[model samples]
Target: MKSSRGILCSAVLLIALLAPQCFAEDWLYTVRKGDTIWGLSHKYLKDPLKFQEIQKYNNVKLDRQLPPGVTLKFPMEYLKFAPAEVSVSAINGEAYFVRRGVRATLNKAHKLVLGDILVTNKNSSVALLFADGSELLLGESSELIFDVQTKWGETGMVDSRVRLMQGSAEGRVEHLRGPGANFEVQTPSAVATVRGTEFRVRLDKEDDGIVFNEVNEGTVSVQLHENKESVKEGYGLITSAKLPLAKPKELLAEPKLVNPRSKYLGHPVTLTWQPIDEAKSYQVELFKDKALTTLVHKAQVSSHQVSLPEVNLGEYSLRLRAIDKDGLQGLNTIHHFTISPVPRSPQLKAFDEQYIAGQPLEFSWEESVSATQYRWQLAKDRQFRNIVTQQELKNNTHQLPEGLPAGTYYWRVAAGNIHGFGQYSTLKRFDVKRPKPPELSLSDKTITTEDTLTVDWQAVPLAEQYLWQVSSDETFSNIVSEGKSQTSHLVLEELPESELYIRVAAHGPYNQGRFSETKSVVVEPEGNGKTAFGIGSILLFILIL
Candidate 1:
């Protein structure tokens, strides 16, 4: 019989082998009363004659049946297993995987095997989740290959290996439970091996054969042909075919946005940010989601200013990072901004008019072709809650009625379509300072029976003209004759032989006063041919009193 020690020379070796292979049960077989090494090898081992190999690892007799309850340790590598699987948890954009040689859509429940290739289109990404809860994000325009997918049977340990052929990928590896757990990423120029970390790997698009590696959490070891460098959290490095593994360089500081009036108000959105000391350039990216997985725009700029062409107004997330002279992109600063689509406010003409109480006010604005209508508001305050007049009309001009209490008033106009409205124009102040105009009074009230009737009104001070109307009714809605006269005297060309109403208003340079009180008149022609006539039932009949 062999000694207590099998092929294992020391207890240290046995412990090393036992601890890492937690599935050591997979290598052991229970001894039965009728079991022999000869019978067991033929049943379990591929080569039956290799029963002697089992004898080297376990002190067992081949010539007799082994005692019951005894256990035999077999090599784990020599055992047989099937292809392993990685559960596909999620995907974004148009990402697919090719199994063996058949292309298929990658879904939540899809399982990927070794030799499977994952691909992402432009502006797309894919997320791969392994059975061990490790997650990997394959970035836009990327291709990744599953090199090895294996797990020791029920050992709670996994060995995952993937090769990035192009573009970028980020990973969040679960903490290893045992020595058998490993996650590795291999690129063209370098390889990254991590026990548990959050990291990113990118093959430089500049065709320099450079691989960029960034560690956000835990530690990552980057290996070139013969050199290796350990990158810790908050640090990054780059490796090229021409150079050795580089020392981990601390990432640059994030750039801070410095625009105070940053509503993203106008076209060609322009934003400025504070510059970093070591930054040679900056990269700006926009995403629609807060998680920043959906990339919309990416650009590299030399200055601290970020300018983007007109984009749809909505909620978005932006990422800004500075690039150093060593071609390493620094840490990112993320922010949430909203782009609200609004129409342009119409331009208003200057308000230079003398205002009077109970007088018409005219306000006009420049034409806006984009607006189908305009909203004009006359308010007591700028907030427009205490509004005097608010209306939406197709025309650009607004007319305020008479009887506005003469104090400081505010007015504004905004252009709008069916979709939405734009910003309101600057509040305009209207100071009602002009005095009420003087009412015109007729000096000569005598009646005349002639075909032409003449009436004279008192010429008021600063009166430029007189506007008189002869109406058939008292309300002056049915005006029979109307004319403007420079003098205070008005002559009626024709006088109807019936009851009529006459009114007149004095006009100044810019505005006209209210019409005078209506006067009812009836003309009586004498039987004798003469210019003298009599007025019958005339209100306020007096001799120029």
Candidate 2:
């Protein structure tokens, strides 16, 4: 009897050791706006039909629209065994997690537990391990639940918030509504709150204490939990739980007052001011009135070379401000200028009909009233090479020097005065197309819903029309904006922030050539109010020097 009992005990112990293998795997996936079962199956299982198995096990009926902010789970039997796990924890109101393998997603209703570790997969599913070592893994391609309620024991808590663990997880928050409806995330030291808005949070361990929070729309508040310090609008916050929180300081320097100077209409504006140390770039805003009304032109440039546009006989107010990448604005430096009676539109007629290699090429544009000098450039590629000629011309004709070459050449011209220069003329490319229409490119290609799409492209020919277009499909059959000019290279209005397919095309007359080849741009619209304070250190160093 004793020997038989010993054998049974050994068998029981063996089964207990192998219990983990019996559980299989669990996954968490959040549903986005346009997600389909077919997409989910192919994404996680490499077969759309596999989604059926997942749905049956998860008790989800087929053909249900997996709306945004929904969380779903996949069982172990349907998955292929490449399970991953991550850990997570909640401090303050936000829940933090890390993904190891597989994938994970978040929905609006599911509250993330503090000290939870998650494992992820390619299908955007997640397995959440709580601080108490409890596990909750989602289904493949299922909607996520992004809700938070801190229950002291078994009762539900009110605030619902979570930090991104890994992979891409996007969702909406519905319960946190109204003026007092507050949702937030608390790092070890920092707190991020949502103010009637939708947003995205991405986790990148490689970056040092940098939490990339993007705002698709509405406003978010990133505050130091210890100090309640926060920055508003479209800004980024870089913080770490290991470090103590500091007061939110604006990193922008006060702009120097540019000397009040006279400007001539139809001429390049010579704007010279003491160089600022920490300035990443300068923004020049030209207004028509002393009250700073009727903003005529605004441009952001590293070097100050703003060409005032041809005005229709009126006095205008000018205000210039310098901004760092952190979105901090400096004091506005104001100036005044007047446009005397000028022609309706200035014209640049190419003097040379064609470029005869090895011969002098003389190009001249028709002079406008109140014009003084001309800015000209010669180049091989779109970028100029030789002396960028700025000549004080009483007359319009400029002589091209003899450079013995047997190939085509490109030249560009711009009219300038005291305030600034009018736009540069259409690049005349005898040998090739004039400086490649400013190649519109983006800072980032793939983005979440809460990010912005920064549109850029080659500058349009002076006076030529520029149009910006965006489409879910590559072929921009449905363009976004009607024909507009390229006064500003950036477009940040009414854009659906996501991994959208984008292309920009510049248009001129057929004689000028077909619209320049469409260029691609990617935009990520996220805001956390963390300014670049290091720029201050750099500026201080420059001041010392």
Q: Candidate 1 versus the native: TM-score?
A: 0.51
> Mind giving the per-residue lDDT tens digits that candidate 1 earns over 348-394?
89995456554567888887656888889988887888998788989
Question: Any idea what lDDT model 2 has?
Answer: 0.49
lDDT of 2 by residue, 76-185 (tens): 33433221222332111122233343243443344344333433333234444322233333322222333342221111112344444333332233433212123555
List the candidate 1 regions with Cα displacement exceeding 4 Å.
Answer: 1-93, 105-109, 152-156, 259-272, 305-316, 336-545
lDDT of each: 0.75, 0.49
- Candidate 2, residue 267: the lDDT equals 38
Our tally of clashes for model 1 stands at 0
Error at 135, model 1, angstroms: 2.5
The runs of at least 3 residues in candidate 2 whose Cα sits more than 4 Å from the true structure, single-residue gaps closed, are 1-245, 257-260, 267-270, 343-545
Provide the lowest-lDDT 10-residue window in model 1: 531-540
The lowest-lDDT stretch of 10 consecutive residues in candidate 2 is 149-158
